[model samples]
Target: MKAIVIGAGMGGASAGIALRNFGWQTEIYEAVAQVKPVGAAISIWPNGVKCLNFLGLQRQIKAIGGDMASMAYQDYQSGQILTRFPLRPLVDRVGEFPYPTARAELQSMLLDEFGRGRVFLNKRLIQLEDNGSQVTAGFADGSTATGDLLIGADGTHSMVRRHVLGHDVKRRYAGYVNWNGLVEIDEAIAPANQWTTFVGQGKRVSLMPVAGRRFYYFFDVPLPTGLKQSRDTSRKDLKRYFTGWCAPVQRLIEQLDPMATNRVEIHDIEPFSTLVRGRVALLGDAAHSTTPDIGQGGCAAMEDAVVLSLSLRAHSLGVEDALRRYQESRVERVTSLVLKARKRCDVTHGKDPLATRQWYHSLEHETGEHILNGMAETILGGPL
Candidate 1:
């Protein structure tokens, strides 16, 4: 059997690797001429790590990922620590520590595992045809590929999704703007082994350790969608929004190169009722895009890869049966996560002002155990 994988991202590459492990031929396609990861860094939680392990990339993941030992929440203005807790317990319970990695490193590792030669670049998918037994994908370059199955790992603006659903999916703006980039690791900004965040006034500044002795940092502020700002003015705009914030935040704004920072108006799609139609299945942001509030966007994609592969391996009825089983198993879980992340986004970004204030107060009295427990619930709920 053969599979046509679209997007060549974390989801597509992993799906290719997984399917190949089960004796299937795979061709991965990418729209861009050169593969560049969309973001600077990503948090691959324990569940995502397990999926990578199943795909035989454990060594590569550990090599490119950061060592995160603890997490802290602090006041945005006063810089007082609201809660500090070790992550060791969560790792112990989940059987693996979350890997905070540079997006480029992770993408490179996945592509290497999937075999660079198997991935075709500059092949934007403009059409998909699922004729029961075989699926064909037509590219803008006037080339076409046919396979027994098609996996749409294309992202939030996925064309494959429209084909499967027979309509376009609307993306919802998350009512915030985000700026993220990398900086040299500095203890004065945040501890080397800690994920530290400062929150207040429906805004957030965070720094988390990634590999290479650097910190992956991001700032989030509640703002209107489609508000225009240039890269040249990102630093000035950040300073204005974060004025009178903590010393670390000020330092971050001052030290960060605005030209290098990526500013985004975050958006996510409503969870779909189905992710499959016949031999075509959707994965990653193509299926259930969600706000970054919970850091599960990529992890969920990894899970989809693993589960889809497993479904294929476990079912003997037929390809369609296996795909249906995969859809049935994932819909509820991904739907719940999409809703949960959206709720968290709303609360954190002041969509519910009272709830946001209550969240800050709750953090003050939190002892880390509750937070770990909640994380454990999400991590353990994986198909692994």
Candidate 2:
């Protein structure tokens, strides 16, 4: 089957890889002039890594940043430990691999696997029309292309969703914003694989090492939905927000600097019900956009690609059977994650000081394997 995949991001590239693996001819289109890692660091859970392994990209997975320490947890304001989960014991229990890596590494590896000249740059999809036995994608360049099957991996604000869902689906603001930035891996940081979280009034921060020399931190703060801050805001402003927290946070802000090339992320996100409509399939943030509270945003997108590919490969070419089945397999899992992430955001940013965060942190260790294993069973149960 000739397949046209839109939006050359993680979900789109992954769908292309899966279709190619199934011996289908695939064409990928990206709205961007060039596709690159647009986010900071990303952590791939064990279930998502299983999909990468199925695609034979385990080496790239291993080459990622630091792994979680055997023990991970959240803390209270009283300096008391709350929840602790042993992550090392759950690698295979979860599935295969679960690691946090730089965003560029994952994007670059997928681009390499796609080979050169495969991704058509600057071809923004304008609309899609079903032509009985075939689907046609209309592009802004006034050129049109047809394929036996079309998959829309356009993220968050997907154009494909507007085309297929018949009307515009608005993103629901979860009433908070995320503050994400990276700092040099402090030479003073003694914990090699440790990751930690601290929750305070109306704000929460989670920190982990993305690479040997750099650590990534994202703070979700309860804010007005439509509030906008200057991209040129002084780092001192961010410093003010994070002041008097953990030593690691203070040190991180002291060393971190934002430049034109790097952005200190501050944006709002909401959850979507489902990303698929008719023959057009939505993947990643396009379908389910959850807050980054649980750090499952990117990982959920990676899993979406894997599941969509498997569903298509299991049925006849250009058939709606597979698409319907894809929706069934994904809706519950993706929606569940979306809700879970939002709940985390709410709790983390609540006004309980660090009490709630610490209580959950203590539970993290006990539930780590169970959570990872549950994700594996949910997403990997069907065909790869």
Query: Mind giving the per-residue lDDT tens digits that candidate 2 earns over 1-384?
Result: 788988787777777887888888889988888677766777776767777777778787778756666544444244344455656556645446567777777788887887647888899888798766788998999988788778887877778877766777666666666666666666453255667666556666666776656666666656665545654663655677766666655665566665422433333344455555556777777777676666677777777778777888777754577887888888787877877766655666663546555646546455566554645554453234
Candidate 2, run of 10 with poorest lDDT: 260-269
Evaluated against the true structure, the overall lDDT of model 1 is 0.93
Number of the top lDDT candidate: 1
Candidate 2 residue pairs in clash (backbone atoms < 3 Å): 82-362, 83-361, 83-362, 84-362, 84-365, 85-365, 156-286, 185-213
- Estimate, for each residue in 1-384, the C-alpha lDDT of model 1 and write its tens digit: 999999999999999999999999999999999999887899999999999999998898999999999999999998999999999999999999899999999999999988999999999998889888999999999999999999999999999899889999889999999999999998988899999999999999998899999999999999887777978999989989999999999999989888889998999898888799999999999999998888999999999999999999999999999999999999998998899899889998999899999999999999998889988998998988
Count clashing pairs, candidate 2.
8
Question: Model 1, residue 9: what's the lDDT?
Answer: 93
The residue ranges of model 2 lying beyond 4 angstroms of the native Cα positions read 74-85, 187-190, 260-275, 351-384
Give the Cα lDDT of each candidate. Answer: 0.93, 0.68
Backbone clashes, each candidate: 0, 8
